[model samples]
Target chain A: MITGMDRLAAAIQGKKSDRIPVFCNLIDQGAKELGMPLKEYYSNGENVAEAQLKMRERFGYDNVWSLFYVGKEAELLGCKELIYAKDGPPNVADFVIKTHDDIHRLEVPDDISAHPAFQETLKCLRILKSEVGGKQAICAYVTASMTLPALLMGMDRWMELFMLGPASVRDELLEKCSDFFRKEITAYRNAGADVCVYANAFGSTDFVPMRLFRELSLPQMEKDLKPVGIDGVVYYCGGARMNAVLEQVIDRLGIGAYYLSPLDNISEGKKIIGNRALTCGVINDIMLIGWTMQEVRDEVRRMLDAGMPGGKFLFGTLVMPYNIPEENIRAMLETAYEYGACVEEATS
Target chain B: MLEDVITAYNEAVFDTDRERALKVIHDAVDRGVSPEDVVFKVVIPAIEQMIKSISESFDANLAQHFMTSQIAAEVTEEMLARFRKAPEVVGHIVIGTAQGDLHSLGKRIVIGCLKSLMIDVTDLGVNVPPEKFVDEAVARNAQVIGISAMMVHTARGENGCIMVRELLRKRGLEDRIKIIVGGAPYRYDLELYKTVGADASADDGITAGRVIAGLIKEVRR
Candidate 1:
């Protein structure tokens, strides 16, 4: 009997799994399902882990990763004003780096162990490892370094820096972020995280040019992930038509898994990712929100048909929308189970 | 001289040379290029040409797109400041990201697009409340209210455009001001715009400007 963890590990290693593992980005939806306030669930680690586990169990999925707000780490690192909302994660209300002098003053946290967000995330990882480590894979999430300048400085300023400043200025910011993430990844590893998932929205083709995405983001990601001694890392660059970047990242980064957005063409994505790294998304979030259950099932079947022929596929969404219907989610998993198993049988 | 300025500024923007780009504009103005002519003829055309070049190439990335637009916007702002006279406002518009959606890359790009077209825009900044949209539109007598919601969660329900639409109707400004939405969510489903009660939606910033401009024309006519 193959455990869910075993199936995910197998899929990541480019081996034939018992079936295609279903990866649901169910952070907000998990809180809503458990009838917990978004504020409460996001404030503490135990609640975050508990909500994620419940979501995984309900869906019979292969993994449950921590999906906290992207700004938690930034907030801990002295971004003063954070907007906590009832519907979503906290965001930076004000930026700290208002001038060139501020960038020079900013440094990686002196003690990563003492950061409240770090402590909370470690607690979440420990709880997941102790409770569900036997059956489900436990991954920990961190905002990628390339995406953090906007948190320290407002996004408009960050975009201006890219437009106006020398590449060195942008690199200095990324380097500081990289150092912080290195320590964060190490902390998560020490806490027994099975994989380190890096969410680099800025690294996506939607935000950065290919030259910068390749020249800046890829090298910074390599530096961040190289220290993580976990079995694999999940790199998510959120946007469509990123295969050009994805192809380079897969070749350069040592990560064993990739979360290509639903906006991406999955077949071409699969070809870019190849068998070395497991590809884990294709179903656009809008479809899950607006499509009927039958349409959801059909979409899942189509993704599976395209990806399941190869051994390196896991089913997931781009960004799981809040309050997605339980039935549509169930429909996606069922389609994956039924058709994904057929591919499994043939490969085995 | 204008063509030389545009070509030189284009190279500066392409090379990410902000100083040179600014110098080119300033020098052109020193040679008696009116500020408006500099904006309408040189700055806007240079940025538009850059955007067109990027779109033609499959390898163009986000940096080129953002950098080109940012230069155009900055140049427009600089010249407008120097001139000390606001160009005749072709149309008044208000724009922002809806409440809880902090993503502003799309909104900023749209701002550049609108400014380049000589639209008088008052940006309310990110995380704008629904009532604020109506309040500002009414106060400014704006022709359009542009709302951006990047994430699906933000795009749906009260957190995003839907709230703005409902408030617009309640304030009786729904018919007076056209609502246009753009972002990742709307790019996939234009019907989502209809559900949110937006008059129109565009996937890209340039198209959003064109769509909003057309809708404004329809309204004033």
Candidate 2:
């Protein structure tokens, strides 16, 4: 039988796996669960990587995200100038885009050797690729480009553009952001990441409306995803009701997996995407934030039952937080190990 | 006529295509829509639609998320500019980034929603100390102050509370205005806000808007 790691790499690449993969979004529980100090992990990349390696070795989960989240991408962009936050990733300097003119003047960054966080991300991936990527799979993380301009340009006047100008102009901004991510994704894959994770932490269920989904996000995702080819996980924020949108994304673009938090009605999603895409994540983050080991085990059991009847189902928490307790994480991994053992797929 | 405008506005807003929205607003106005009708009927509904879209569909892509939002903000300002009548109550609210937090998305959404309510909003942008919010409230004689933080760690936000206390101590204007907080980090409850000694806390803009309106009314009464 193929090992869980081999299975995950296969399923992610649309190949066959031995059994289901025990997915662990360790980035969520890195600070607390792994016993790494958040301040130190944020300050020093080597410490952060060491901490991540510790969690992977300790938990023995199938995967590990290179860093806390995609703040590194924002750091790569020139928008994060006032970054004195050495304790963590550099944050957007100030949300003052100054004027509409600032939007046009801003250029999406692409030079990776010069991008500090991108370089750090690549370095970590390189080390991991040598250490673990072949053993399992390594997901290289990048943030959405348009998200930053809004962060940098300020949301207020940027919104006004929809009312004030031609749609083509806004389209231009979306295009530039897409180009930056595509380039970065290529760089990461070339550097030896097994998969690339398209992460947008701000994309929540109640966050943005639907039409923008079709025009702006979907198009950009489709465009960049084509180059990413087969091995990419579309890690989106949750809006469980937007099943139609999710189905459309998988149908329009050949996404390898969908990593979401709330699985409010995942059975329905399983039917919607069929075997075309793998399903990842459903355990609620709040449960792990304060639950005991037993409680965490129960939640994992519940999600595995609800989400993993079929072969392509990977086990993950609802969402990972950087501050969840270690015992909770231990429970989560142990539960997956116990229940995920050689399950027969209900799939015919 | 207003109903028709609202329907069209709501339908088109989700697309995040401001051009279609511009056409809808102009059409509503050409039909002799009042500025109030245009804003409340045509613009706000579209804004709400766009907001819903951002939350659901386009959210995974932060670039689209911000692009759609920026378009929403520019649209709000443009629509308001067309209104010549003295706004019924050009209510003023001072908004800012909480101390030690620099995220600007939630705060911008709040300001946009308030402006659609025809309330004049004063956004201090990001990373402003809590003192700045209070000072702006005092100078503008602003009726309300809004602070937002997306960071989870409480220590940073505790600094924001200190800024508020310092503001009151220096200006003696503690009773003159109400303070509100919102953002992703505000998970536990409104008590976190109360614990911060804020008048209220909310995660989303609509709730914040309704609560602000209610608080303003109570203060006036």
Per-candidate interface DockQ score: 0.55, 0.20
Model 1: lDDT of residue A207: 66
Instruction: Compare the candidates by TM-score and give the number of the best one.
Output: 1
- Candidate 2 versus truth, CA RMSD in Å, comes to 5.3
Docking level of model 1:
medium
Per-residue error for A93 in candidate 1, Å, reads 2.3
**Worst lDDT window (10 residues) for model 2 chain A?**
A82-91
What TM-score does each model's chain B reach against the true chain B?
0.83, 0.78
- Report lDDT (Cα) of residue A83, candidate 2: 46
A77-100: candidate 2 lDDT, tens digit per residue: 554554433223335555435654
lDDT of each: 0.75, 0.62
Question: Alpha-carbon error at B99 in model 1, in Å?
Answer: 2.2
Interface root-mean-square deviation of model 1 in angstroms is 2.8
